[model samples]
Target: MMFRKIALTLLTATLGTSGAYAKKAPKFEQAHQLTSEQAALVQKSIGQEKILIKAIQQRTPLVETYIQDTRPDVKLYQIPVGDQYTLSRVDFGKGFFDKTYETKDSANKKGWFKGSLASITGITKALGLDKHFTYNPTGFMQMMFLDPTGFDQQHYVFSYVRREFLGSVRTWVFDVHPKVAGMGRFYGRIWIEDQDGNVVRFNGTYTGPKSEDDSRYYFHFDSWRMNVQPGIWLPVAIYVEESTRDGEKQVGLKAQTHFWGYSLKLPTRDSESVSMKVDDAEDKSEDSTDVSPLQASREWVLQAENNVIDRLEQAGLVAPLTPNGFETTVLDQIVTNLVVPNNIALSLPVHCRIMLTDTVEVTTVGNTILISKGLIDTMPRNEATIASVISMELAHIALGHHIDTRYAFNDRLMFPDESSFRRINMNHNDHDNQEAAAKAQQYLDASMYKDQLSTAGLYWSQLASRGGVLKALNTPKLGDSLLKTDGTPWMATIAHSAPKLNWDDLAQIPALPLGSWLKTDPWDDHVHQLNAKLYAPLNPRDKMPLEVTPVYFRLQRYDEAQSQAANAAAAKPNPGAAAPANPPAAGDPPAQPTGQPTGGTQPPAGTDQPVPSQAEGPQPQQTGGTPNPQQ
Candidate 1:
């Protein structure tokens, strides 16, 4: 429950005020006009009495609130999660009662007295009240509010602080402090209306838990009352403020309440003859109005669809095919085939529109789908690739990938910056769920048009060949740099590592590269170094062109297999390392070196052959003479 403290010290200040003598009873006037010295003594006496009464009252019957038997003009209700996107109003008939009060005067002259109460169901459900809400009264008043009975005589210290005016209300202020240490929760000023000595406002600061640091928490309250009868006042409105801190930052949390519907006993022989009616009601009241859950769901879907479509067009994904081109082609196709069918399948309806943007990406805002020209350009020259991207995004929407109740009604769902997009990933568990989704996507992709499936595979192969930004999929912890659209380290890496192919080969392909439609930085130190170190080792025969593989496809497993084969080829033993086991050709001398040709004079030209060296054992030679050692 929301807590609001009404200062009691101010009540004493109001009653202690001095005024001109009147014909009132001498005892009453004398009691009201105490000399300065007498005032101090009387305050001590009253303070002690109050402490005693509070202790005794601690065990007495605590008041229970009941709704007055009357109709209320307005009501407020909290929306449940899941359906929070649609704020529906619920009305619980006018014949209802809410809070009740005890009578102070049988004649109904003085205001009805009641302790304050507050309903926190909405906040409790939304954030779990126990986790987020705490009562932090100031230091001097802590014991008084919490213990209710642990008051020592030395703790009864009250001092007249001041007299001031708040809004249209004149009040007398006073300070109440604990005479002894560790006796209370608050040390601050309170203001009371002079007319009837009722608390009207209070402001104070509270210290933290006794064992923690002595940091102060500030609080304030203002109460407005209606004159229910002559010389009587009853509270009709209250506003409270409490300080909240997050790390080093602090902010104020404010709450307000308006009371209506009052009941009073009638002057009848039977005390049971009591009546109630709306109290000080206003023309405009906040009341709950009911709405159908199904209708609310439909509205949310429609909103999502609109939001996505708007973002797509703004990004220039869909062709702005003239005035009606968007409606006639892209939007029409989506409504007929995608949105309508999906709505029927899910038992949820949606209204969707498509927009064309120049970006090479597809993203969603609510139910709205955005497709970009760059995305189109990157696709293989076929319908399959287009379907693949669209279907993937559609799956995300159908599964509520990016839906957030907090931001359901927000129109600015598009990524404001890279940081925000990163936050989205951090908030969602997309990767953990992707494997399961992929399995399902495979079937969906196959069941769709054959052309779409064929184009999808072609797109995948093309992107695999091109080691552009998509190459990040192959390396762990390397893709973040490649996702940047700006010409930075990521873009440079994509450009340097992209597979190269002859112009003739590219021309023969049906699909062509979109060029650098999205500009990126050319200078990347890591990219340059990696390229320099790797270029010489890559075999021309094993090299694949950049345009053959789809970036989003899972091809790393295949790439790893190919890399293992290449490594094995490089590590294989060389067959030529050992010496040949063959004898020298005809005319070759048996002994060579310094005594070469000693036994046999000179060998004929082209016929001379030397004996094979020990390193090169006897082996057959293709030529007549010994083959050159190098050969």
Candidate 2:
């Protein structure tokens, strides 16, 4: 797993080192020039960049950045040594400014981002990555824009590469570099969609002024944007990586930054007001019986749950509830599979929601369970593993560990979105978690997943082994950490029985890498299972559980009409196609087998298998969750 040490100078240079610059001499004979049509597209892209900048200024979005510093490891190849995390709601109205959301120490600070000129300086000071030599945090953010002030033919030279397809959008590829040696200039390649001439993706590093080594101050990054609205593209994600000499040692870092909550500023009425008193409205229940004492107590707790969930959603911390969504389709089935077999009866049905962060944590805000996206992404695509995690929160519900009743008062949740982590507390106490853990075991043993406990146990073992290095990732912002205070995972009982860790065992996939299963929609903040070809691991090194990997998006445009048309076309049968065996007649219902309802619901992929392979290989589809409607 040792990375070949590369020269910092060559790693941070412009395309000149690759002969692209050498080919473009004074005579321009070996230069690659853009055709008239391509030149027009480039001009349109320049204007679109300006439009994107202006549009972004009108909205404030949440920006989350996570960094993992790695040194070479003999066994695991490269293991993280240190990590950093920062979450903020950035206001780009007049300049780059942010209100910290994940930390209370700097929650009230107003100077995270000052302006364009000193933006890098503000970010470096805020991130505190280095005190001796500053590494620009804004360098990653600036990847969203080619150049804020100047991004045209006057300042940059564009050479045509070719036409390419990024997901469903066809793009014109071009390599660009600054015309003169200048400070903070973008030198990289861009992918511009052919339809609107908007830059869909850009990858490279920023160049420093003459005589300065850019590698010390800048990092290589790949930034991607999504068509959030018609003719409006916004930055969605950025992946940054750097390997350079820190003193005599070869040190490297990998980081990712995600942006969402674009429509946070849009005006909408409060959801709580929808049930306000209406004229001549009467009770709808036929019995007209008074609510019992038990029902009243439960309703009181439900009030607190509803308040917190609503507030989190409004603050862009939780995804909007969508029917047949990931939670409803995949997670809900897992809950049912556990509850029905255990014969657990509840006064109200349990539900789940995803917290839109890359923290490995889970908690119950009353009966509703909240699991972070990072936890879901890292878990092996096995039903028992996911069920094991969910069963703990389900135990909390059964044990009646309710959220604090104070939150039922609407005024308690009136604080700003930036203070969400500070104001709200949903994590369970140690005693309660211990009790729930024991109860969770009881539920798992009585359920259909009893036989697969060994596989689920391996996940806990893998998590416990990496707990020391991945502290920041495992630390929860709004919920409970899976590990106890002494570093043992809460489900230590399961890990104790798991098969011993064997690095050479390629088939033993303890956990999957981060971003393996779920992807978030930038515009709507919806989480969906990735419809990707799951490949079996070629070696044990391929199973990089809970590690930060490079980000590659299958970029596509947002077109509602085109999407519907495609869906309809897919549903239409071929005229010459042969009929299925015993096709149902017209106007008659399709026959469904007894004991299993047709299309009623299907479990998340791999419910029947006790041990599912979690690897990346080129073959038939592997086990995971159901495909999203937008697929």
Query: Over the stretch 223-246, how does candidate 2's per-residue lDDT look in tens digits?
Result: 999887777889999998877666
State each model's CA lDDT, in order: 0.30, 0.70
Clash count, one per candidate:
63, 3
Estimated TM-score for each candidate? 0.27, 0.80
Q: List the residue pairs that clash in candidate 2.
A: 535-616, 535-617, 536-617
**Best by TM-score, which number?**
2
Look at candidate 2 and tell me the lDDT of residue 576. Answer: 21
Residue 353 CA displacement from its true place in model 1, Å: 6.3
Q: Which ranges in model 1 have alpha carbons more than 4 Å from their true place?
A: 1-290, 294-298, 301-323, 326-359, 409-448, 467-510, 515-631
List runs of model 2 lying over 4 Å from the truth.
Answer: 1-31, 97-112, 115-137, 211-213, 266-287, 417-421, 560-631
